[model samples]
Target: MDPSQFSSQPPEAYKSSGKSGMPAAPPPAYQHNPAGYPPSFLNQPVPQGPYTQGPYPGQPAVTVQPAVFVTAAPLANPVPDYLAYSIFTMLCCCLPLGIAALIYSIFTRDANNSGQRELAEKNSKTARTLNHVALGIGLVVIVVIIISQIVIRTAR
Candidate 1:
């Protein structure tokens, strides 16, 4: 005696087949994008009114600074050549000490030019010492010669 038990069609089909003589409500609006974007954004329409600032503008500004390097100046080292003094010692003073002074003077200049600062300084000091020794020996020899000359003149 049940109508659905006797019918072959499903209950849902019978409900929508218009057999009851009443129209069904229109189907819900078709949503093209299921992501939830508004219909106006999906359709072609220029946006109206001022908009709020975005999370970031143009991927945010990037600032990069260059590296700087600093270095201190080298120490000041001056080495002098005693060639003039050596020459004066050789010509007017002791011959042996003057020769040693001259050799040291040449060594000082060569070492300085070759970037051997310590060696150049040592050689310059040696040259000055030799010059002083030569001057002292020369003064003693001069005094002795003068005394001998005075004694000879007094005897004559």
Candidate 2:
């Protein structure tokens, strides 16, 4: 069979002529309507402008407002959290005082994040004080242990 003839023939004709041996049904006919679409959709006018009137009749027209943005100014002298100092004291100095310091440092950070300036400052000061006391006590304890070891060795 010629390829050109095959391309021109309908699919049903090809199938019927093959092993089935059945007659090919007639191809469907195209019926064009004078009116392309329903009158309701085609006759409706498109809305214009940024703001359109409400869907129901006699409703007020909707108005669009521009977006607004607000930003806070950077602080001149921000309170310190002293997190690293608290952590260091907690790990290397005294356990109880260091833990307290660490807690205050966390509080300071939380207050700072919440925009509570006075609370942040207070927490920061407390953390600093706790760290200092813990470090001082650690140093004194270390000195006392060293002196006792030296005296014990000498006595032996």
Candidate 3:
């Protein structure tokens, strides 16, 4: 291609592609007075009647009372469930009593959670008693077995 074919200015197709080179006409002057326009709702006066104030005539006056909310207070000293003691007795001490203790312990926890303070205390006491009995029985059995083994060895 000859260097003379490419002019410094853009091609005719590019120059005519966009908006016309003429400046836009100035926007119509804003009419401050809305003279020819219809009346707006803002210009109209608000309606007044008996319905605006309170209850209709002859009916009792309605009083609005503030809402009241009541929540229960948390217990100061919660009862002990004795769950660990019950489990230990069940596993190592006596099976039947230990199982009973575990059940009572679970009952105690459930009662406490359900907001039954009296029931929780009762179940807690029962579990503790059962654990004590189970542990006592286990200790007595162990002692008796050891004594018997000692006697057998001496006899031999």
The candidate scoring highest on lDDT is: 3
Error of 1 at 60 (Å): 52
- Residues 18-69 of candidate 1 have per-residue lDDT tens digits of 5766775555665564343334443444334445232232477666699987
Write down the lDDT of every candidate, Cα atoms only.
0.79, 0.79, 0.81
Clashing pairs in 1: none
> After superposing candidate 3, which stretches have Cα over 4 Å from the reference?
1-76
Clashing pairs in 2: none
Error of 2 at 58 (Å): 25
Please list the residue runs of candidate 1 whose C-alpha ends up more than 4 Å from where it truly belongs after superposition: 1-77
For every model shown, what is its TM-score relative to the native structure? 0.50, 0.52, 0.53
Q: Per-residue lDDT of 1-156 in model 3, one digit per residue for the tens?
A: 898879865666656544778654555655343443332344543335423445443689989999998654444676899999999999998999999999999999888776778998999999999999999999999899999999999999
- Candidate 3 has its poorest 10 consecutive residues by lDDT at 31-40
Estimate the lDDT of model 2: 0.79
Model 1 poorest 10 in a row by lDDT? 48-57
